[model samples]
Target: MITKYLAILRMKYVEMFAYQLSTMVWMFGTMVQPLITMMVWMNIYPDQGESFVLYFVALIMVERLTSAWDVWEMDRQIREGTFSYQIVRPFHPIHWAIAENIVYKGLFLVVLVPCWIILALFIPSLRLHLSVTGWGLFLAALLLGAVIRFAMSFLFGILCFWMNKVTAIYAMFETVSLFLSGQIAPFSLLPPVVKQISTFFPYRYMIGFPLEILTGTANSHTLMIGFIGSFIWAVVLIVIISLLWNAGLKKNQAVGG
Candidate 1:
């Protein structure tokens, strides 16, 4: 399995570099919204400008690290009948999606971490000072966030077997996630009701939980709750994706028959 994964990673690395320009463009494009939100928050509360800077900068890092694009990829592949190739492979198709994610996010980390270090030198607000435990917990939450997001995307991707426009549906989900996942603003700044409601949804776990940990806003109680919530959502999403994969394969076979 390790050998297979290594090979897949190599292939994905090559594929990623093949479109190096496009990948660079997309990675930087995702930064714009968070930066704009940072500026707006700075304007709204000029006194809290440093806080907003830290929160939004951390938001960009956490968001990119946890982001998933499998839904769109699988939607197009399944719709155009290319996904069948993956279905027939010796390994599960989800593994390929997972490999792609690992490769892409690795690229993101390579670029973004150094950028953060550089920015922190000039902008004190971009600096982070976490203890060993805090760093460990942040990494743990980030991994969980990535898993939940990938599972959620794959779940909707497989829905393409039954629906003609799964991407559109996933787009709506992303639109909601933008606000609920803390992409639009820090959870601290959101209304009380929104913060409460975000707790019940997977969106918060996907990006907000990790950022909360990194930004030092989450206290002991909040960390406890965030880890538990993220774990529960990650498990739930993975199980649902498994169940849906079987059902979708049956549907796909029926159509092919």
Candidate 2:
């Protein structure tokens, strides 16, 4: 099974390389939103401490790393009847999505690091301050965030088996997530009620918690709470995805087989 996954990963890397130019363009497009947000916020609060810039920089990295474009690909496969073949394959279809996710992010990170380094040279305030323990915790939070977000997205994509408007539903989700996940602004900067509410929702754990850890803003208590919340959400989502995948497969068999 490990070998099979490795092969899939290698295939994805080759596929990505074939479209390197387009991939670079897509990477640039992804960077623009965060860059613009950083510029506007920096201008508005020029006196804000270095932590402010560091938070946004971490936000950009988290966004790219946790991105799940597999939802669109899953939708396409379902719509075009390509998923039928995958259903009968020896391995599960989720492995393909996982491979694609890893490959895409790995390529984006290759481009992101050098670009970020150059930007950091120009903007001295972008430096991050983290202790050794903080770095370890931040990475754990990031891994959990990525898995939870990907599972949520995959479950949503599975809805295509029963509904024709998954994209519209996904758009609605994105609208809510943008504010709740700290894409619009740091969760710390949100209103008191919103900030408290964000803690209960999985959105903050998906992006904000990791950013907070990276920026040295999350203290010990908050870190414990955030990690626990992330773990609970990850388990819930994994179960939900398993149940949905089984149900969706049955529904597909009835409708198409």
Candidate 3:
């Protein structure tokens, strides 16, 4: 199992770096949204005052580290009935997904980190201070966020077994998570009711809560609350996945191999 997992990681690593130019392209491509945010915030504060810089830098950190849409891969497999090979394999499909996630994110950082340094140089005024402990906590929160997002996305993808096409449904889920997760904007700036509602959902903890903690915007009480929130989401998602997978297996019908 360990060897198989390693092989998956190795293959993903090789695939990630397959084209060095493509790596640069994707890095710059992903930078657009964050850069646009920086521009808007910069315009809002010409002299580099206010939360613009903090928000901009925090977003930069967020985009550089974010992963997306392994659900598409899962759906493709399920749709084509190729997932049966995975069932017969010696490992869980989640391990393969984890390997792909790790390899791709690591590869992305190779491109992302340098852009961050360049961003700091170009906009030195927008630097967000990240202490070592701040960074440690931030990384933990981000990891937890990734796990939560992956579990949720994969769960939705598995739902394709019972749906017409889960891409649209998964997309809706992603969109909701994006807003509720605070990817589009800071939750603090959101309406009080919105914040209240987000707290009850896993969306906030998936990305927003972690980003808040990373930016040191969360007080100790909120941080503890966020930790508990993220924990519950992870556990609940795990249980949900267990139930969904068993049902998906029972209902699963195949076309070809």
**Model 2, range 2-54, lDDT digits (tens) per residue?**
99999999998899889989887876687688778777777878888465677
Which has the higher lDDT value, candidate number 2 or candidate number 3?
2
Clash number for each model? 0, 0, 0
**What lDDT is obtained when candidate 1 is compared to the true structure?**
0.90
What digit string (tens of lDDT, one per residue) describes model 3 on residues 131-225? 88778888888887878878888888789888867888888887776567776667766678878888889888777777787667888888888
Clashing pairs in 3: none
> On a 0 to 1 TM-score scale, where does candidate 1 land against the true structure?
0.97
Worst 10 residues of 2 by lDDT: 248-257
Candidate whose TM-score is highest: 1
CA deviation > 4 Å runs, candidate 3: 19-27, 41-50, 125-128
lDDT of 1 by residue, 101-199 (tens): 999999999999999999999999888889999999999999999999988988999888899988888999999998899988888789999989999
Evaluate residue 240 in candidate 2 and report its C-alpha lDDT on the 0 to 100 scale: 90
After superposing candidate 2 on the true structure, give the runs of residues whose Cα lies further than 4 Å from its correct spot. 253-257
**Reference-based TM-score, model 2:** 0.93
Question: TM-score rank, highest first?
Answer: 1, 2, 3
Estimate the TM-score of every prediction: 0.97, 0.93, 0.88
Give the C-alpha miss distance for residue 90 in model 3, angstroms.
Answer: 1.6
Runs in model 1 lying further than 4 Å from the true structure: 253-257
